[model samples]
Structure formats: C-alpha cells, structure tokens
Target chain A: MRLASKASSPPRRRQSFTEFLGRREVMPFLLLVPVLIFFIIWNTIPTLWLLGLSFYRFSLTSGRPPIFAGFYNFDSILNDSAVWLGLSRTFLFVILAVGIETVLGLLLGLLFWGSQKLPGRRVALTLLFTPMVLTPVASGTFWRLIYDPTFGILGSIFRGLGLPSLNFLGDAHLAFGAVLLVDIWMWTPFMVLMTLAALASVPKAELEAAEIDQLSWWQRLRLVILYHGKFILMLGILLRTIDAFKTMDLIYDMTFGGPGSTTEVIAITLYRRAFEDFTMGWSSALAVILLLISIAFTATFIFVLHSRDRKQASLAEEGA
Target chain B: MTTWRRHLYHLLLWLIALVFFAPVAWIILSSFKTANQILAVPPVWIFRPTLANYVRVLSDPGMVHSFINSIVLSVTSVLIAVAVAFLAAFSFSRFKPPGTNFLMFLLLSIRMLPGSAAILPVYLMYVGFGWKDSYWALILFYAMFSIPFSVWILKGFIDGVSPRFDETGRVNGASWLSIIAKLIFPQVLPGVIAALIFNFIFVWNEFLFDYIIGGPHTTNVPTALSTGLYSGGGVDWTFVSCVTTLYILPPIVIVYVFQRYLLVGMTFGTVRGEV
Candidate 1:
C-alpha cells in the first residue's frame, strides 16, 4: 500500500514519454499491457464471439451468412440427446477419475510420506512423477496399442493366463473403463504430489500433540490430517475436475468416442461439432456452457489459492 | 518403526515405482524391436536390439521438420512467456494496485478457458487474420497460454524474496529494469527455470492448436505424430514406438534433471516446500 501510494504520487514537471512510461505507477500498468492485450484478443473477444454466435445458425462450409435464430440453439440444446449423453458421460468420467485418483493418491502419498527412512525414495518419487509429465496424446496413443486384443503386451499376457483377449478399447462396455484407467494412471501422480503438499501444510506440532493425546487413527486423520489438508485437497480436486471434464486429446487419441458413443464426453462433442461438422454457432452454445462451468471452477481455484496465500502471509507476519 | 516394516516399505516403494514406470519402459523397448517381434504372441521379453526404427523415423524429412519445429516453437514461446511473465509478476508483487487480487483472478479465469471451448472462436479469428499455418500465431498463442501460469508461479517466488532487496537496489542507483534483471531475477532463477521447463513440456505436448491451425509449414511434433508423417500409413505399432521413444526422451531427461523442483513446477508454485 505504501508502494502503491508512492507509485501514484503526483509528478512535479512535464516528462518525456519514455520517462512517464517508466514512472512507478505507469510502469507496472505498462508491464501489464502486453499480457492484457493478449487476453483481450485471445480470450475475451473469442468468448464474446462464442456468446454472440450461440444465438444464430452459422456454418463454415455452407457459404451462407449466419441466420439469427433466437433461443433456438439453447432450446435445441435442452432437447439434444447427444448433448445430454455427452454431459452425463463427462460427469461420470470426472467423478470416477477424480474420486479414484484422490483415494489412490492419498494412500500412495501417505505411504511415500511415511517412508522417509526408505532407501531410494527420491528415485521412486521421480519415477512416480513420470506419467504425469508425458504428453496426454502420446500416453493415450501408446495406451491404445497396449489395449489391442492381439498384438498388445497386455493381450498376450491375458491369453497366456487363460483369460480371453478382449479388445479393451473396442468393446463399448469396456471402453469407458479403459479410458478411465489411463486417466487415473496419468493423473494419480498429480494427486499424490498434491497430497504430499497438503500433508506438508499440516503443522508438525499438531500431529505430535495428537499422538500424545492418543487419538484413534481415524480421529487423527479426520480431525487433524484432513482438517489441515482440506484446502490443498480441494485445490487438487478442482484442478483434476476441470482437467478431467475438459479431457479431449486423450479421448481423441484413444477411443475417439468410439463403440457407439459410449465414451463421448462433452469435450469430444465440442470437437465433433466445431471441427468435424463445422457447426460454429451450435458449438458456441456448448462452449458457453463449458466456459461457465470452468469459470465456476476457476473461481473456486483462485479463491482457494487466494485464501491460502493470505493465511500464509498472516502466519508469517505473526512469526515475524 | 520395526525393521521388517521398514523393509516392507522399501519393497513397496520399489514395486510402486516399477509399476508406474513399466509402461514407459515397454514403449522404449518396443522401439528397439522388429515389427514382428513387437507383436509376438507372448511378447518378446529379451530381444536383440536394433536401431532400425530410429533410422526410419529420423530419415523421414517430415518427422525431422516437425521435431525441430517443436523444439523451436516451444523454446521460443516459453522464453518469451518467462520474460513477460517475470516483468508482470514483479509489478504485481511490488506495485500491487487496489483490487489487484480481483484483477488477478479475472486474468486467471481467462487462462482457464478450455482449448475446445475457445477453439472455434480462436480458429475463426486466426482465419480472419490469415494466420492459419503462420509461425507468429503459434509462437504468440503459446506464449499467451503460458504467461498466466508463469506469472502466477513467479509471483509466488518473488513474494518470498524480501523487499529489502528492492530498497538496496534502489539505493544503489539502479533502475527498476536492472533491479529486476540483476537483483530479483538471480534470486528467483530457480522459479524461472521451473517455469521454463514445464512451459516447454506443455507446448511440446500440445496437440489441438498445432493440428488444426498448422499446415505443412507450421506442423509441430504432436501435430505431425497424430495426423501427418509417422502415422500417415495408419496406426503402425513400430512407427508409434519409434516416435514415442524419441519424442518422450527430452521430457524424461527434464523430469529427472529437475526432480526436486518438479513438485513446485507441477503445482504452479503453490507447493514451495523442498522435496
């Protein structure tokens, strides 16, 4: 605040353009302009375009001007079975992926955290983080091969064990589960990392006190561990939810909404409309919905980060 | 802890690590096998290695072009993003105006706009500007996407550094730019490097914008691997193996090199604790 005031303090004399631009108040805003322009052009305008175009019927290939159809797209969306199907599938994917990842992550993370005395722990952590860093397309593409009924290693192993060689990705009933497994495989490490971070936020004194008080394991976990790690866990959940909900590239590379639309999430739906069918206006309505949902998640994410930041700052102030 | 329990944890850590790494190992091993060997019924556990796959992928001009393009675009965009994000982060950390937090949230909301949601509008906008297949479009857009994340991470790092450094630099008659570059930058170099590494991995891995907006001229590795060369003949296991192995090598090295900082980088600096 002091700096903010000094930055805005009145100038005594006329200054050159460069000097004015270099002024404390001016420079920060000046530094911001490039990024500001970037967002306006890339994000803001396009979102406005998405909102506006959703009210009309427009196509890329029809060689026709947009025909205004007020509430038609939204009205149609209300009755659109594909839209409903995609949303339901997407919600299912988000829930299953996020839920499983969180549980697995917590268990694995607790194990990793407790194994501080374990040799080669650092190497294990590095290896565990490997999958999360790989390109989703590459991971999905490779996983696609791995799920092949004939040539895949998994298939061969399955046959060797006297089990049927099922086409993991080709079967409608199995495709969603197969994709969900890969999502878990890829993202579980992220959850683990977040879990560790959350646990790190738990003050050691509190844990020692809990131990001295002889609280039951569940009581300790529920009252102290979760209570402290809640925000970070929520942050992780929000992050995973958004990413899982918007998952397209992995699905695109894998089943591609195959086996009779069994795995078609909303992201894939949006891709189909905009790129495959070239229905710009119709997809915009869908985009608007996605935009809103993501905005809500982003709001929560920012709020969590903001509140945690403030809490940390206040804690530091007290320590000082 | 009991000795047996400690030993059990050791086994568990090794087992977990191996399970996580098996897929990656399989992909790499597949790259060294013949097409027939790769598809063997029982799966070839021990095979005579060959460089034939690498030879084929590398000899292809298209693969080479896209791979180089991926490096150039990713490195360039990440560098630009780091520079701009650093400046902005420094400003927000030091000269934070009123409602800065609100503004920052709005900035990040734009950042969170999913690619598919904005694909239509962005694609249309690119078409309007004759930017499809343009180098500047990708370079700029990649930087744009990376900026918000970098700024967030760098801001956290910059916040950790004391304001006394700023005052000292000012007292030394240094300009703000110099103070940023000479003083703050060195202090936050780790954060900068973290941002650079992760951002590079991101752009390198990005598929959609490159595949849709890129043409013969601008195709990056992901775009090429998906729709262009390597897989042009339709899903060849040997082809995928070669491409995946070569493609993932850089990321593998990076993750290993920055193993300690991976958490901070991965979490966008929300986790500042050392590994």
Candidate 2:
C-alpha cells in the first residue's frame, strides 16, 4: 500500500538552473540554512568544547589555552564535599518529585477517565492545569511569598491550627522539600495529562470484557488500562526526569541555592560557579556533566519505549 | 457506588483543584490588599479591595515601556516562528526534501539541550557580533528555539490534510502558492491558531534567554519581578502580586479562548497514533 501511494504521487519538481534561484522549496531551505549553521557553530561546537574543557585547567579571564589536566576537574568534583552534597540533593529531588508526580498523576488520571460523565470536568481540569502554564519565575514569586516564615499564608494557617510554625525556605531540610513540593505541584498536571490521554485510548471493549469477567476495579485497571498505558507512563516519567534535572528558574528565585547550597541542583550550582564565582572552567565542566546525565537518561527511556513497543506489536500479532 | 460515594468523589476533585489553584488565587486576592494588610494575620479573607498597586504600575514610566517590549518581542518571535514553520512544513509534506527526517531530528534535538547549555556559546557569539542588548539578537534566538515545536505539531496537522486537494489545484493550473493560500490555509486554520497560541505562551514564559540577553535595562516582567530590586529590603509584596497577576493575563486569556484547540494540538499524534 505504501509503495502504491508513493508511485501515484506527483513527480517532485526539479530545479531548472535559472528558475532554481526563484524556487520556493530552495527558498525555504535558504532561509533555514543560516539558522541551522548558527546552531551548529555556536550550540553544537560549544557543547563539544565543554567535554574537552572539563579535563583541562581552563580559564576564561586569562585567555590561556586549556591545559590537558586529565580528569582533574572530574576528580576534584568527585572528592569535594559540596559536589557530593549537590549530586545527592539533585537525585533526591528528582526521585521524590517524580515518584510523587507519578502516583498523583495516576490517581488524577483515574479520576479524569472515570469522571468523564461528571459536570464541571472541564472546569476542574482548567484549574488543575493552571500551575503548569505559569512561568517558573511567577510560580517562584508566588511560592516564596507563601514560604515567608512568619507572615506568609502557610505560617498563618499553621498558627490558626495551633501547630508549630515552619521556616520552609529558611531551614535546610525544609528548603529541599519545599523545592521538591513546588516541582511536584507544577508538573503533576503534565503527568496527569499524559496518563489521562493514554488511559482514554485504552480499548473500551477490552475493558468491558474485564468488567464482565468479574474483575474488580483494580483488576480491570491492572489488566486492561495499565497494560496499554504503561509505555506512555514510562515516556512521561522519562521526560519529567530529564526536565527536573534541568530545572533552574524556580530554584534560583525560591532559594538562591539557599541557606547555603541546600537546594542547589546541578543547574543552580553551575550558574553560581560560572556567573557568581567566575570559575568558567569548572562551570563548563559541570554543564557538560549535566548534559551527559540527561542524554543517558533519555537514551535509557528510548530503549524502554522501544522494547515496550516491540512487546505491544507481538501482542497485537498474536491476537490477530 | 451509592450517591454518598459520588458526592465524596466530587468533593475530592474540588479539593484537588483548589490545591492546584490556591497560589494563583492567593496572588489575585493579595493584589487587592494594601501593603500592610497583605501580611495581616488570619490572612484577611474579606477586606476592602484596592487597585492601588495596579494604578501605581500603570502610571510608572519604565513599567509601561517594559510591557510594550515584552508584547513586541513575544508576538514578533512567534510570528517569525510560525511563518518559517509553515513554509518548512509545506515543503516537507508536499515535496519529499533530501534528508528531511534527519533535518527534523536535528531540529527537535535542539530542545533536548537545556537553555543554560546553549546560553554561554550563543552569548559569546552575540557579544562577538556586538549584538548584545539588540532586539534582533533575542528575537532571532527565540524564534530559533520556537521552530522545533511549531514544526513538529504543524507537521502532524498537515499530515492529516490530504494531498488530493493539491492535485485538484494543480489539475486546474493553479500554482502551489495559490492552492496553499486558499485550500490548505483554510483547512489547517486550527493548527495555525494552536501553534500561534503555544508559541506566544512559550516566548512570554521564557526567562533565561530574556534575562541573559535582555540585561538590566531591558526588563521583561518575569525578570523584573524575579530580581525584584529591593535595594534596602523594603520589598513591595502587594506590588509584586499585582505584577504577577498582570504578567499571567495574556497566557490565561489566550489559553482560555483557544483551549479546545490547545488540547487537540497537544494530544494530537500521541493518542491517535494507532487509530
């Protein structure tokens, strides 16, 4: 069928020498070329350069060439107390936020899928969707106000309940949780949207079959809905993981890397090192490390997605 | 389930929705309070509403200029992105261009590289060309980043459009441009609208690029509010809330109007890929 369609398609227009100069197809590429070249030169080159610079004794100010110091930067970061602290905090934030978002997202998706007949479904979704749309700076500003230790809404609420007041941002432990809380609050809706879309696409007859088979709600979900939704859920988790790692704006505004680097994720740490501390070389090294980590995470996701896809294909063939 | 269980579900949904919206609700409420009253204990649920902060911001000279700059930058960049993506999508869908898939993969991969990673090199290039603080530098860069999404989504939309219409136009001796302007344009209007709205929101929400490139003098609303210039620590909390409300207005309004299209556009190929 694909071959038949391709054969019947119109012959693609060839470029005549004189008219080629005036062709729209060529025009499109001509316009697109400079941008592509610019990305290649600036974006692609600098990214690769960071890998090289990570090993060298690089300096931004002196204009000295990067010396091949052979993993000195990596070794230093490994040995440094602050580096371990930042790495662990970053991992904790990602795990906690992704974990919470996945559970909450599943629950919300169930609610959305089951509550389709409910009135005000759209209204509920619109409200739930608002936070995800808000810019991180705006969210940060709003949350920072709420985090005000003495006079904030949170404090006032706790006081009213006769509970001990908490310094959400001022304290170290709370600061980490506070950042993770904002992340979960902001992104859980995204997870809900993805999972809900997947759930909505679950084969209805199969679900009904499960229902007729005397399966409980949990069984129906596990056997029918989840079987179909698993790949998309994996996709959602992988996307969120990579994104949470790169999250910088909210962290910057909310904590400024905090009461002393308590909430400092890699992005925040890299920004401070490069901009505030003026250690360009070290910052570049940190940036490269973050890039590699994200790439690895995404690659693993692709592998999982592909395997799931293959499994689904076989399942379809067997049923047929 | 009984009626009571149904009511409980409704209540649970309402509570979840309220949790998601509480911060926004707080900002809107605080916008109406006086500076001193904003921090009032028990958080004044009922109080005399005031537009003093809005009045102050509206009358401020620099604030108005920054607002204009924000609107201009966002609209212009989105326009450029949508226009470029439109042509590129047309070329891809109609004429199978050389290396099209690779080109698309390359374009989408730009999104994977974090904005921070791109900033250092792009900044160096801009500084080299003495384009720092120039509107063109920021607009061009923003449009470049915006293309991947516009292309991906619009390509999906265009793929749904049949090629018979193009053949019909060709049989009638109509040129490709005319056919696109008339036949394809009308059909994919929703796609165009969705892309425009998404691009607008994306550009408006962008901070890292705006902060790094816009510098101190050119303050986008997010940067201004974020780096709130509380030199002596007498921060205007109410004013900040008011600023947040105003900053959020454009996206909210756009999203509200075109929400159905937004949903379809975002979920298009993802769910429907099989069917």
Candidate 3:
C-alpha cells in the first residue's frame, strides 16, 4: 500500500503562504527551486539551442546570418562517412572498456570485500582508487610520457628485455589499444568503488537468513547479493557506458585521434566538427542524434528499473 | 573465506594496486631526477633526487596561474553545488514530493547530457555576452553540472539517516532551517564532503569548456598542459614531470582525508528510490 501510494502525488498550487510552508511538499519544492533554476539555465537552454541550430545552416566563424535549412544538416551528417565511423568506433570502445572494467572491478571488489580483515586494505584501496579521480589531462600526459617509444620507461623496459621499443601512440594499430589501456587504468577503479558499495549494500540480515535456511553460498550470493547490488551495479554500468561514449579528453591528450584517425571516436568527431571545422548546423545535427541516442539509453534503463521495482514489490507483498 | 585464501587475495590486491600505481609512482619519482636520468635506459630505479624540476615549474608564471585557477574554480563550484544540492537532497529524501520520479529522471538526464553536444551554444552564448575568459562562465557551469550528482549522493546518505532525528529536532521547537542546519547538516557532512571532492575533481579535470570559453584570463591546468607545453619538438619532460606530479597529489590527498566516507560516497545512492 505504501509502495503503491508513493507513485503518485498531485501538483499543489495556490496555497496560502503559511499553509504551503507547513506542508511536506513545500520543503522539497522550495529546496529544489534554486537548483532547478540553475539547471534550467545551464542544461536545458543550451540543449534546446543546439536543437534549434540543428535545423539551420550556421557557423560562428562565418560572418552571416543562420539560413534555415530544412533537414539539410541532418541529411548531410547521415551521409558523412567520418560521422558513421566515429559512432561505430565509439560503440566498440564503450563495449570493450566497460566490459573489461566491470569484470575487473567486480573481481577486485570481491577481493576487497573478502579482505576486510586483511592488513593495509585501506592503503591499497586508496592507491587503487586514485586513478578514477585523477584528471584525464594528467593521466593522459603521464601515460604519454610512459608510452614514449625511445626514451620512456616502457621503452627502457623493452630494451632491457632485449626487445625493440614499440611506438605505441604513433602506431596506427597500437594507438587504439594504448588509449583503451589508459581508459581501463582510469575507470576500472570506478567500477571497483561501485562494486564495493553494491556488495556492502547487500543486506547482512538477508544473507544470515539465507544461510540459516540452508541455502548454498551460491544461492545466497545470487538471491541476496545480486538482488540488492543489481541496481547500483547497473547504474555504474550505465554511467560508464555514457561516459565512455563521450570520452575524448584522454584520447585528445594522449593521441589526438592520430596515427591516421584510428582512435577518433564520436566525441572527437563532434569536437573537430563543431570546434575545429566550425560547421555549427551540421555538428548540431550530429549532436542532436547523439543526444537522442543517450536519452533513449537512459529512458530504457529507467523503464526497466521501474518495472523491476514494481515486480519485486509485488513479489515481496506476496511473501509478506 | 579461508585464512590462507584471504592472504592470497590481499597479496593479489597489493600486486594489482602496484601495477595500477606504477606509472604515477614512476613519474613522480622521475620528477625529482635530472632530465637525463629521467629518460635513462633501464629506467634508473635508483637515482639521486633533486627539486630542480619543481623549482623550474613553480617559477613559470603560466603554470602557477593555471594551478591557482584550477584550485579556485574547482573548490568554488563544488562548494556551491554541494550547498544547493544538499538542501535539494534533503528535500527529496524527506518530503517525497509528487512527481519525484520524473523530477529525478530529469535531473539525471541532465547529468547524462554530454558536454560536446552543448559546447556549440555555450561557447557562442559566452562569446556574445562577453563572458569569454571569465571565471563565472566556468564556475556557474561547473556548479550546475555538479548538482545532480551531489544531490544523488547526498540524498542516498540522507536516506540512511533516520527521520527520527528530524522528529526529535522538531519536538525541541527547532525551525526547519535550524533542524536542517544544526541537525541534518552534521549528519550528512561526510556525504557533503564526498560530493564536494568528486565534483571538484570533475571540474578540475574538465578542459574543453576551459579551452573554448576561457582564454588568456582563465587558463586552467589541463589547457595549460595541452598547449604544446608537453608536446611537439623540444619537449620538456622535466617540467611536465613536475606538473604531472603536482596534479596527481590533490585527488590522492582528498581521498586520504575522506577515506572514511568513501564507501558511503561511492555508493551510487538510490536514484531509483522513488519506486
């Protein structure tokens, strides 16, 4: 009943000032207003502006008024080989990077979870999680140095082992993997951070109850830990996917989509399109497409999560 | 679950962490070495250290200015974001307003919006208003960008705190502001701090907007690092090593101080709680 009722709240307007202040809704509404105003300015307006620009032929660098072009920008962008190439590459990168990070993160998080009694766990965790928060510019800059073919550490290590130093960033084939490696280095810890949270949020009482009921360890993990951790874990995955799709900072800093455009993803393409090329209308069209894709992703995730919550609530009601 | 297995896990964790930390450690170590020693074959595992690099980088006006800008911009934005988001989070958690789900979805959608998509209009808007190279352009945008996350994290934390505290505060004839300030604020301070650090890192690391809208007046650290300073012919690894070494310290230091609240912080709180 409580779960059912939380789904709906009627909008209240025209209340006396004191009466409004006295109500519970007033607190949330009042508290949220300042932030709502901020986001309206910073987020919504720009997004809408971009959408408007998508339908017009415009360029900031060009000294001319925006000519309204009906679907011309969108049509041209769809036919652009570079744009499609960027999108496909970005998708592949997101899949591989997020996949590896999730697996590695879960493995490491499990290790940490089981190592609760282990010595120096805090220090290890702090050290490991540092990369996630490190500025991409710094990480990229440092990694670039380390990846330097002739005079860098990796190069020296190679030479010491009687091997020729490889030009990782300059090699077309190697550049993508090198960039992906740095991504894994930076983001895998984020997965570990979230995994720890997810695993921690697994209700202790539920696990104990499952054990007492003679459930196998596997069953306990599945029915308890996975059940509770799925939302956080899914959220982590979703956030990473979105972020990885937008990744350009690391690539820009490290490779600049170089060695023959091998590492150029959607973000790089967008950057070059809007910033360098200054094709405002066409780039805005691409941006609109990308935004729609992102929105579709988040909307689907929310829909699934909502349905799962409802099903679980009903299941709980039955059990209760 | 066994003792020996736990020991093995710990050992494995140590090894992986070392591998993960190796690049940063090597660079920081290299920062103290002479330029020749830094690029030495066999990597000069053991070397006499010096502060020459630090001295050189610190003396550079551009590097110092960018560092100061990075610190000021990040701290200010994250602080504002936390202060606003905290109240909003408190509201979201406590009041459970109608359309909370839709409201939250709208919030997260904003978070999910990529920077590249909006850079066109934002850059143009800034240019038109003569806000180019202004601190407000960055500070306000970063603050806005940080809000959804701060709220999400803070709301999750506030959820963990019992509403009984509010009830208790109210019974003592405390006003909402007093209860929120004196009662709730202390309870969620760790969460607030965690949010601040995270958003601070986000703003600090962000360079695209800084590159576009910020020019001579507001050159942040990333843009400073990017502009052929560390690249192209005649590169200066010594200066870069110093800058990189310095850049790495802030996040690690923040983590060290906020280590206690990290688990609570990193947990992607219940953005799904409206259900």
Candidate 4:
C-alpha cells in the first residue's frame, strides 16, 4: 500500500548548516547583518568609546596612557566658564539664525505658493536656491571676502553712503552678527523650499472659500494656510535648529571662533579642546555633552512629528 | 490684484531674487577680474575680463591635485554607499526583519549626531591605526555616515515599487537576489541615481572631517581652500574668487540639472510626504 505522502514533505534536510543559513526566511537578516555590523563598528563603538574616554584623564601629548579620573572631567567641564559661555552663545546664534530664516522662508514660500501662474517663478526659485546648494565652506569663504573691512563690497557700500566702513568680522559683536547673517543667507532658502511644499498642499477650496467670505488676512492665515502648513513649517524649523547647532564648517572657515573667543560656539570649543589643547579626555567629555544635546533635539523632533502624524490620523478618522 | 499692484509685487519678487543672486554673481564676476580690479573702490563693474586667475589656479599642481582628490573621494564614497544601502534597503522594504524600527531609529540618531562628537573618537582611532590622511579612512567614514540617509530614501523608493512584481519574479524561479537585481533595481533606478547624486554632493562639500583627519596627502578642495585662506597672509581676492568659482561649479550644475531630486534630497524626508 502506498504510504500517504506527508501533507507537506518532511522539511528538507539541509546538506550542511550553511544551507540552512541560505533559507529565504534568513535572507533579510543576512543582508542586514553587514550594514548592522558596520553601524556597530563605526557608530555604536565610537559613541561608547567616547563615553568611556570622558571619564579618563588622557592627553595625547602626555607620555602616559589614559588614567581613570573618575568624575573629574565632568566636574571641570560643568564648572568651566568658557564652556558655559560657548553654550549660551550657541543658543543665541541658533535663535537669531533660525528665527530669521523661518520668517523669511515663510514669506517667500507664501509669495510663490499658488503663484505658479506668475511669471519667472521657476527661474526665481532656482536663483533663490543657489545659495542653499553652495558648499557651506565656499559660502563662508565668499562671505569672508564680502565682509572684508577695506575692499569688500559692504565696505564700498558704506563709503558710498558717506558712513564709516564697519569692521564686519573684527568687532566682537559684529563678528557674531556677521556669522549669523551668513547662516541666515545660506539657510533661509531651505525654509522657503519646505514652506512652499507645505503651502502647495493647502486645500485650494478652502482658500477660495476664505476669499469669497472676505475673511481678514489673519483669519485666512489661521483657517487656511497655517492650518495645513503648521506640521511642515515646524519640521523645517526643527531640522534647521538641529543643523544650526551643528554649525562648525562655516564658523571654522569664517571666524575660526573669532578675533578672540567671541564667536566660539560649542563645536569650536570642542575642537580646540581636542585638537589644540590635546586634552583627549576632557574633549571627549565635551563631545558627550554635545551628543546629549543633539539627542535631546532629535528626540523632541521625532516626538513632535509623531504626535502631528497621530493628530492628522485622528482628524481623518473624525472626518470619515 | 490691480495691474499696478501686481506689477509692484512682481518687481518685489524680482528684487528678492536679485538680492539672493547678487553674491553668487559677484563671485563669478570677480573670478575674471585682476587683483587690482577686484579691490577697486566703487567696485569695478566694467573692466577687461581676464582668464588670468583661472589659468593661475589651474596651473597650480597642488590645487589640481586637491580637485582630483575631491572627485575621487566623493565618487568612491557615493558608489560604495549606494551599493550597500540598496541591499539593506531592499531587505528592509521586502522582509522588514524584526526590530527594523529600532534599528532605523538608531541609524538616524547616529546620523544626527554632531560630526564633532563622532569625529573626536574617530580621529583618535584613525591615529591609533595609522590611517590618518588615508583615502580609505575618508571614504569609509563618508560611506558609513551616508548609509542611513541612503537606506531611508532608497527604502522609500523600493516601497513604492509594486510587490506583485517581486512575487512574479519569484514565481519564475528567480532567487531573491536575482529578483532584486533584475526587476526591482531597474524600476527604482531613478531613486538610486538621486541617492547617488545626493551623497556625491554631500561628500564633495564635506569639510569638518576633511579638515581634521585629512592632511596634505589627502586634502580635498574645501579643506584646501579653507586652509589656504586661513594661512595666506595677504588675501588674493581674485585667486580666491577663481578657486571658489571652480569649487562650486559641479554642485551648482548638478542642482540645476536635477533640481527636483536635489530638492527632495536636500530637504530629507520633510517635503517628500507632503508633495
């Protein structure tokens, strides 16, 4: 009598363990393993090493290896006046740059929002985005030339106006403001791009209804434009804020943390600590603090994005 | 809007565009000016344009070497990143292994970390391994840093591909790897190209790591320009302008040609879902 064939043939016996590893179910893990390993080696390990280094007293220039210094590195950084100053200055810079960029970007975005019918909008946009695409280092270099006290264009303009030529990058306050201006110039277009995308998605019917109702400008903004654009606008702000915090290449090229330490932001301070001072352990401590601040910003961004998404989902469900 | 008001609005928009374009135009124009003309008070708008600065910069072997280095580093890093990211993204889009969300979050967080924070340990590690100024060091760092972005973007693109296509391939006895390589990849080729271009532009413009880890042997254009400017006592405005012009050419051209993709790439994930 023919034995009833197993409903599914008994699981095929693998010739070797390697054949089992080649199964379809394991394919994803196999493909992902290499990338995961890379991330662990490059990103995870370095981060942990940085954390470990923070607790040690290691100087590259010193003959001795790293000595475990307990909390000394952390304690010194916490009490250091320079570190505090850098933090505050960075905060101020982020505020000024991101604030101005948001306003300017929104205005431009609104201008071009439904104005696709308008002449030269495409060309105008391309021109506006030119600055955003340029290498930040190159932008910094060009701006440095522009802000040159003697022969720079701004200087010539000042002279033309019968005013004393200002030292744009020389004076302590001016240097900070100058860097802020460059940051705004380079990034405002980014704001405009994101804002424009958001604005494009604004329900045209609502806009027409507001127009028919003769709603005030503020009312139209509140009920039509902003209602739709808030999520993307906030996203743009969050991204810009994080990036503004990471502003080092521009500062490195533009001010080198300044005529003194006037323009020294946290990144610059960290750089000096690690490279200039060769205080490996201390700089690593600063790096850890900087990483914490970045994580905090990123976490807030993700939190806000998720809540917005959920809110949108619930609103859709309510509409349904 | 009234005709006059509309006209005025158009004028204002044009003015804004002009303000943004002025600096870029000035840099390009200055590249053609002599040093005296570059520094001329009441700025020289009309002058006999010269290619002297361009010739001078091109003639410099060191500048040419850095330019080549920038090209090599950026292209190599982008290719490696795209290849690795495509495989991982294919896996993510297809199989979506357990804890994919956690892994992705981890990757993004690392990408978001300040380069300075990561660069410190990386710098030390490089020194310890005697990898300073090595092409592999820069290429590997750039490729690794870019993988998260590439994976995110490429996975989004792959997700857009129809699952039925993969199923059909598998029905025809195509292995997973063969299906991805033959069917899905060709369909997502545009996205792959976009990712490649984005990574290229990013690595090309990168400065901090190039500044710290890179030295004379491996100096890229940005590092070279910055260092030259920082160290040179008397600034040669014309020469600097020429170098800046040359430095920005490739990115500007790429952005102009691939404006749509470049815009999405530059904005990360913010504009993609909305538009």
Q: lDDT by residue for model 2 over B107-221, one digit each (tens)?
A: 6556655566657556545655777778877887788777766776677677779999988987897766687789888888878887788778878888878887777556677
Clashing residue pairs in candidate 1 (N, C-alpha, C atoms within 3 angstroms) = none
Candidate 1 root-mean-square deviation in Å: 4.9
Cα lDDT for residue B162, model 1? 97
Regions of model 3 farther than 4 Å from truth: A1-28, A202-228, A304-320, B1-9, B161-173, B228-232, B271-275
Q: List where candidate 4 sits over 4 angstroms from the true fold.
A: A1-24, A118-120, A315-320, B1-7, B230-232, B273-275
Residue A177 in candidate 4 has what lDDT? 90
How many residue-pair clashes does candidate 4 contain? 0
lDDT for each residue of candidate 3 in B2-53, tens digit (9 for 90 to 100): 8787678778879888888887788789899998987776678787889989
Q: Candidate 1: which docking quality band?
A: medium
Report how far residue B50 has shifted in candidate 2, in Å: 0.4
lDDT of 1 by residue, A1-320 (tens): 99999879986777888677778779888877777787788778877887899999999899899999998888888799999999999999999999999999999888787767668777777788889888878888899879989888789888888999999999998999999999999999889888888888889999999999999999998999999888888888888887888788898888889988999998888899999999988888888888888889888887788797798789899999
- How would you encode candidate 4's per-residue C-alpha lDDT over B174-248 as one tens digit per residue? 777788889999998867877888888889999889988887888999888877873557777787889989988
CA shift of B93, model 1, Å: 1.7
Error of 2 at A133 (Å): 0.5
Give per-candidate clash totals. Answer: 0, 0, 0, 0
Q: How are the candidates ranked when ordered by TM-score, highest leading?
A: 1, 4, 3, 2
Each model's TM-score for chain A is 0.91, 0.85, 0.84, 0.92
Error of 3 at A65 (Å): 1.1
Predicted complex 4: DockQ: 0.62
